[model samples]
Target: MNLIGKKIKIRNFDENDLGQFLELVQDKNNHKLAGLEYTNDIEFGRDLLDMYRRRDGSYTVALQDNNKMIGIIELNKRGESTELLLTREIGFVIDKKFRNQGYAKEAVQLMLEYGFNDLQLTEVWASTEKDNLAPQKLLERLEFKYIYEADQTLPYTGQHNLVKYYLLKK
Candidate 1:
């Protein structure tokens, strides 16, 4: 499925997206900010393909004109708790080259529409590093209320980082 925005398109990952996916992850800044470890292995790409094939609710944000994937955005369940199903955490990563463009905002707005209108979700949340002003600004521009400040575990780095949480109610 595809979610169309003004200048970007959000769609599911497939084999054809492997190269772009690798490029997205290989960027050092992305790894640092997102706290994700990337490997230059075909198995990793296969794993991502399998993930998309599982029909999980995630999408790759791409440019409309060239169909070049520039980022990723998704609303993911917080945990295994059934009560948390109505509340999903929103996450996104834009390529360095695409930063400062409005694509992230547009893609996120599309996901918000999908979550609230189509999924019937009640709330969406996001957390970002305190130093990451871009995402903080984007979330604020979308009117996500500041929820709290806390130490968040970095997935790849295995360290605690200062993070601020934001929430938007549907």
Candidate 2:
């Protein structure tokens, strides 16, 4: 699936995307709220490539006007459900240089559409650090309701305190 909006396009991740993907993931500023640190390991990239090949979810790259990868969006099922009703979790990370441009919001909107329509999900949910205003505002703009607060710690950076959001498809 492909999702285009404004000056960005979301497409499936390719092996060719390895270089840019690695750079993005290694960016500390871009992953501040996510509590991720810089890394230069090829194994991390390979693991991500493997995840991209799974049918249960997707790893999409957000391309800019110059066709450079500026972000990534993922939609994954939280559990196995034989019935049509199911729930999914959504996540996104945008490059620091491309932030404040609404690309993450657009990418997430497209993911929600795919989750509700294509994947036939009953609800989609996401969580962010309580202090992360960008994602909180983005989720609100997408009509996701503030669900509850949880004390969570990032295993990577050890950041704690989080707020969760939920969006139910009508």
Candidate 3:
């Protein structure tokens, strides 16, 4: 099933989306924004798709009228090693050509609804590099409160860096 939006829908990814997915993964800026190591291999794309599928929530944001994949969004469970106090962290990356458009905002709104209401979550979290202000502003627009800045290995990316955190409570 697809989460409907005015001009987009969020749905599970399929093999046919590989081309557009590759395009996104190949774009230097987008790839970096997603905190991924640069790579052009199809195998890495396959691995990424598998990883996305295994997350708590993962969906492709596509055009409602044409089903063209425009971006990807996910909510993955994060917590301490004790298996308690698990939290859900949101992440997204838009196709380079689609940046600055409203698609990412709409898609994130859809995902937040799912995370908060459907998933019965109390809060959703997000983080980005200190230099990534676009995402910071986007989160602020969505009413996410700025948390604190910290230096740590971005869990998903395995990279150590300064990062800013944000949180929104339902």
Query: Per-residue lDDT for 44 in model 2?
Result: 75
Number of clashing residue pairs, candidate 2: 0
lDDT of 1 at 11: 86
Question: How much is the lDDT of residue 117 in candidate 3?
Answer: 77
- Clash pairs, candidate 3, are none
What tens digits encode model 2's per-residue C-alpha lDDT throughout 17-49? 777778776876656675433566879766765
Worst-scoring 10-residue span by lDDT in model 1: 31-40
Tell me the tens digit of each residue's lDDT in model 3 across 1-170: 48999989999988888888888878788756677545698999878777765655778999999999998888877765544244589989888788898998999999898877787777888998889999899999999999899998767988778889999988
Question: Candidate 1 or 2, higher TM-score?
Answer: 1
- Note the Cα lDDT for every prediction shown: 0.83, 0.72, 0.84
Task: Kindly report which residue stretches of model 3 are placed more than 4 angstroms away from their true locations once superposed.
Answer: 80-86, 153-160
Candidate 1 lDDT, tens digit per residue, 1-170? Answer: 68887799998876677777777767777766764446667687567656754657678899998888888887888877888879899989988889898999999999999999998998999988788889999999999999999987768998878888999997
- Candidate 3 achieves a global lDDT of 0.84
Clashes of 3: 0
Q: Alpha carbon lDDT of residue 144, candidate 1?
A: 100
